[model samples]
Target: MKKYFYNNIKSKALLLTLASITLFSACEKNDDLKIAPPTTISDADIFKSPARIEGLVNGIYKALKGASLYGGRFLLYQDARGEDFINVTANNYTAYEAWNNSYSSGSNDINNLWGAAYTAINNANIVIEGLAANPGVVTAQKTSEYVAEAKLVRALAYYSLIISFGQPYNKDGGASKGVPLRLKAENGPENNNLARSSVAQVYAQIIKDLNEAEAALPQNYTSNELNTTRAHTSTAIALKTRVYLTTNQWSKVIEEAVKLVPQTQAPFSTTATAVKHALQTNIANIFASDYTSVESIFSIPMSTLDSYTGQSAIAYIYNTNSEFYVNPTGILGDAQWGSTDRRRSFLRLSSGKQFFRKYAKPSPFLDYIPVIRYAEVLLNYAEAAAKTGNLVLAQNLLRAVHQRSDASYVFPAAAISTETALIETIWKERRIEFIGEGFRGPDLLRNLQPLPAKGDSNLQTPAVPLTAENYIFPAPNTELSTNKLY
Candidate 1:
């Protein structure tokens, strides 16, 4: 992880120097004039200019899109671990190990993912510390906002790491060992020997970061693109709902959710000052050409010039070649997911196989990957409502999501007759709503449920019980080899 901090600093410094040279070349017209760029830039120099500071801030977000992290593999690995998809190709380069629950500490998948997440975390830490040390690089307001943005990114990275590498908070109230908590910036190997913090400790820090971020983040950005792609006050609150839900803080989920989802009925929308978010009237519209829909609370923006390549593209793995297909015996087999439901439209059939179509951009897939959606906030609130015995609001919230996808469909009496049944329905709705978006594994683990077995006799994978060693990913060998205290 410290290696990542070192590399990021050097690379970003080079980028800043090159940018400065380009700007100078554009403005200077003296034919004989020459300017020598610095061979090396200190950390202080990187934060000396507003443009340089902004570049570092953007780099923190760029780190989140690493191929092994949110670019594609993280979502693919999570869904593969669930029962929804069957692996058509048993290639380990993909998520075959995750699908079969066979990954070890030395596995490339675990190591790469661990490295990617920590790289993002460390980068955010660097920006946070750098900005603090040089307070006037930007306006006090801009400085606070930048630091808040870094905190939000760091909090998210830590949350992702904890859920993947540590036991479920519900399982032991977060008593299990978690990945090392690296709060301070480290630019060299000197600080590589850190011990793991308990899962509870990590959660506490995540919450602390989020609370501070929410306090300082803007209510919304000037444009829809920025609102969907960057951190905002609503984004922080939305994420808090998810974090609180995973920790089974039922009331806390409600508390945070209502901040964005203030309405008590259908067509629920956020009361944010500039960026008003509500469920898209047409569920398919969110995944269509326009990915900047208000429904998208936060998403990783991708373009032809900057997007996942090769097998790392979500469309390539799930749709283009059908590496994984919807399991006939899994959620696709759920009778409740009626054929008339509009969400079923996301499924495609070619050469006698069913594939997901949410990410349908061909070749160089440029589809924006959703990080969180307003729909998720509604459902998160609904689940918490049911868990807290507010079945009426829970049923109403569940109906909002269900009816949005299938307006004509009505819930059977038995499905919503009790609180437990309503909660179960909400979970099922989540699986259907977020099939290719990567909420399956985390949802199951948060509930302490087993990762159900899938596949036919030819490529069957066994069920991973909650107590299984592979239930949560092992700490990668990369960290174990470097961190002596680990």
Candidate 2:
């Protein structure tokens, strides 16, 4: 509650200028100071107390809450840019452009996203450096956990950046250019001119950091601020499934997902205390204004206590809309299940007005932004296992997620008789399951699939191939101009 530093990128950037040393985390908004690294409290003075260090770490989560990052806008951008949500405002031309798959490197949304991610990555680096130095105060366990958390935060940022900015790792062995991998916590003019890492290198670093994170983090933390809001072993494993899925590491994806999600129990939470990672019965309640449920592996905490403002908020997207419309197309319309699924309870069709009920307001803007969930982990395993010739295991995993949302739903053996069919079935399930959750587009990109016909009108020029030049977001023009390497 009331975290200071992470709220805005300006203050985080100011810290870097003041320190003349490395700044940590970077997921704040700063249209003016483009390409600046993330920051924390003054190193020597702030480290005298453990509470300060804790708050600094808390700041990392706060920074991530930037509307441009996870607070809400990122989800909106992903979904709107994909096939689900349509931009109906007509006046918001940039959004329509995005829907049409034509956003440029100079696009404000692209720049905003690029800045937010680097801010988080840098902030994570700052934390890692501070924890390693120890400041001669915090306990060993605390230090290790903090360092691991930093790595996790950093990995999430880097992975997001790589996938969004460069080609998917499965494309040509990840030979494309990725955003700069700034690992060290140092501040110098030269540090600002860093080079892009190869997509493969970025993935390797993400895996390495995640491994350190998984090893150091505890099984669970009792509070939402610690467990759900922060990283834990299960959180790391959950992320590995996402990472491997994107990189096309079929075996590794199943392996990591299986580590946390049980093959038999299906939707059970793993930790002993506070029911850390189990699936809750009610599907609607998970997206309500209250704190996250057992299925929440990692999420950014948002609520009436800490409300989101501006266009980025979920409340703005679904609730206050003359701008965007909740429209699920492509795979959903193709898969007959979307019409009858029980999870459609999350949607509302009143007086011909349709919008998702997940962040509906009377509750205003209090949804705890989901980063990943048990359902996704199961789906990831299902996809990976199917690809790896484990049809039985794949069917079981897919059904676990399916049955949770629609009790009447069942997968027949003929539905997934072959490995190709199983993979296709699981992929379609993801399209329905994650609708409006900003995953549909990335799901297409990573799978090397085509765009589902970009929202009818602006894309009338013969649907752009998913392989178009601007398919993935380009690196921010600001970063390209600032760096000598470009």
Candidate 3:
């Protein structure tokens, strides 16, 4: 686990050095605290020197380990809002469940998200600034690749901010104030009063960063682990596909999806392990354990002992307290999960409340929290194909996942008959297929689709009205109070 965190530092450091170059004034302190020497180096001096340039780039990936972003908080808040689980105590997740005004400026969710995302964005900005100042430090090709990777990460951070703060940042009645745009290191007071950019401007920035990332990143990195871990050209493409699709750029969505189809390069296309990839072979293992299968395209590694236990804490809070039998509460249980599907075993009811068995053990374990996966790529292809009048292709894709799950349930011919129906079919499949993994709500709202109240059988809680306002969380009080932009 330590190895996983440390390994990426090399690349991250190199990236950070590039960013710092533009933001900081070079100054070295004198031993007697009298006169100091200028820390600034000649462009030739820094570029001619190999060691420091590499160190800064490596710093970028290290920042990802921060708890506010991928380190843990990001995935937790996202999962909390989706349809799969309801917050009973409603402690941290009250606003999400009620779809009410509970998530005001003072809400923890709002504040945490705001802080974490900017932390990531600022880190990326610093990297970009530094690289801009000393372009000659690395080969032109390598430098560009680093630049692209940094931008991709920044875009990803902003995308998270845009969606959480408000959907369609630039769209009608959107969150009037979006996330702050930090292009340089905010190391002092002048940077503190930054204001929010409009949703439109945020989206534009996101697109710009992604476009640069796609161009700069290599088709694939040489390092095996890093290839799977870090943002690549494919990651940028996949994210842009999502962003375009969300903003209703249907044509561009299809174009990006097409580019991504061949790039996913894994069990994505092969039918041999299709079921396995979707956890059809053992649904319990897929959801309940830290199984890093091929379907996982991007994720954060969280170890019990080495770092904070986000997943475990969630499991414990959601579950009930019964020693022998752990049952999920009525608010969060599938009636059929226990009887027929093996996946039900992932949670056991304890004292009438459903407790996730995945991370319930007394001891700690290694868990990798997912950021993205190949399943998304497959789904994107299906959606794009369906939009392009290739209903058969889309139907085949849905059927593949369903058929992979239960051979006994007959495939429906109606599943892929029309674009409208195909979209609905795909949405339902995603809800069931990615349950507890956190893609459901956004998947529905981003497309401007109607959501059934909690009671709709497919949605399955009790019918409740959730509106577009539910999509945009309130600005954290801290941001509103301290930052002029909000």
Candidate 4:
């Protein structure tokens, strides 16, 4: 029952000078303003040092990658909620409850994910507020970049929450209810209880934030991994493509995606920007540990020293010895892309069971959690082209992804002549290419498809339909008691 919304958590970077505060303990409307410790560092004291400001930003990133956030359950739940995995009765993993779509509003997985996402959002809110208040703490350019990064992370967290707790944006013409959009820092008790926004309104705010971020973020970084892991102008552009796609802004998707992924080479690439995000010769090696390939636009780092373990780690649940096993029978389990398709090798057989190796398990389950990727950018460009009747360019982009994986899997032009066919091809490739990386549930929802039915006779969770109620998880019971708006 720990309240992560205002928990006093710490990261490796002990900027405790800014730590040790729980914002909502009183639960009284007036007390909500009391976000910091009674004698916490003053704004002047903390903001005078650039290191402290950076530490606050670092803390936000750490919260974003928490076990309940992207660190584990958020992505893991999305994958399980999709139709790719087999829900065998014998495989009674407690975590699979999300995969089965049978969990209640009281479920810990649902509640924790809800709380953790908001916590990350709150962290970003604090950074945004701090940076804005102390305009003279850093150079104009540095301040712009840092504040831009905070906005980028906050936008991402909001989008993730909207996806998990609201209906698809395309459904009902974007009129569906979205989760509470917490933008301002809740440092005081100023009527903080707010109702949900419309899905359309949320997207509008997200777009506003991303546009600001894209304009302010640095165009280049000194190091490759640093560029891949942190927010930058290209990251904002790449993420915009995804946001546009989900909101069904076809033309906008093409416009933003083309900036990152070109028809022949990676876009947003130049001697100045240095975003060389084209496919590597071998797609199989893209997920190699400690290596940041040209295709990784933005990812959260994980390693031996900073890796997820126990049930919260994605690799832990996907392990054959654990509650799940790779299915060997469906189009998902055994799709015949080509004999030489590199992705076909992504699934591995261990201890008499096939396991998904897409995230690329290190000795201790620490594959980087990708948020937006170059491969996805490419697909976004292709899908947008297909949707807008630019069939030739669409096919070229789609074929580029296919050949990158197999090198010889030639996609015939006539096979995907119609827009529907080409779009389907791109979607299928996205599903296969990102297997176990957590796109299955989202893909299904965006496409308005039914959740994969229970593959086991003994399990009794019914098939999930394309209803708004089923699409969004209910507000967690914790919120009901704590959040006045609920």
Q: For candidate 3, report its TM-score.
A: 0.74
Per-candidate TM equals 0.93, 0.87, 0.74, 0.87
Model 1 C-alpha lDDT per residue in residues 299-407, reported as the tens digit of each score: 8877644677777788888888788888888888886788999998899987776788888888878787899999999999999999999888898899898889888
TM-score winner between 1 and 4, please give it. 1
- Residues 1-486 of candidate 3 have per-residue lDDT tens digits of 011111111112122224333311111110101122435443344435555555445445545545556654455455555545544443444234322224677766576667667666666765576677777767888778877877887888888877777655325645456667767655444455666787778888899999988877876544433444566676777788778766766678767766645433223342322112232355455444533444554555544333444332333333322211221342235322224444446566544555555434443433444566656756766777777787776766665555445445544556557788788777666655555455655665576544433322222333323454555577777666666655
Q: If ranked by TM-score, best first, what sequence of candidates would result?
A: 1, 4, 2, 3
Clashing pairs in 4: 33-187, 33-188, 33-189
Candidate 4 residue-wise lDDT, 1-486, digit = tens? 111234111111222344443321111121211234434565456667786686677667777787777776677778777656664433323366776676677878777887777777777877787788888888888988878888888888888888778888877777987877778765443434677788888888899999999999998676776777778888898889888988778999988876765545423232324676766667667676434666777877775546777667776666533455555443454343665688877667766656766665745776777787777877888888889888888887877778777766766665689998778778878877787777777777777778766554455346788863665567777666555764
Count of residue pairs whose backbone atoms collide, per candidate = 0, 12, 52, 3
lDDT of 3 at 149: 73
Q: How close to the true structure is residue 366 of candidate 4, measured as C-alpha lDDT?
A: 62
After superposition, the stretches of candidate 1 with alpha carbons farther than 4 Å from their true spots are 1-40
TM-score, model 2 to reference:
0.87
Index of the highest-TM-score prediction = 1
Candidate 4 Cα lDDT to native: 0.70
lDDT (Cα, tens digit) per residue for candidate 2, span 238-306: 999999999889989977876776544454445433335666676677776434566777777654435
lDDT score at residue 83, model 4, on the 0-100 scale: 58
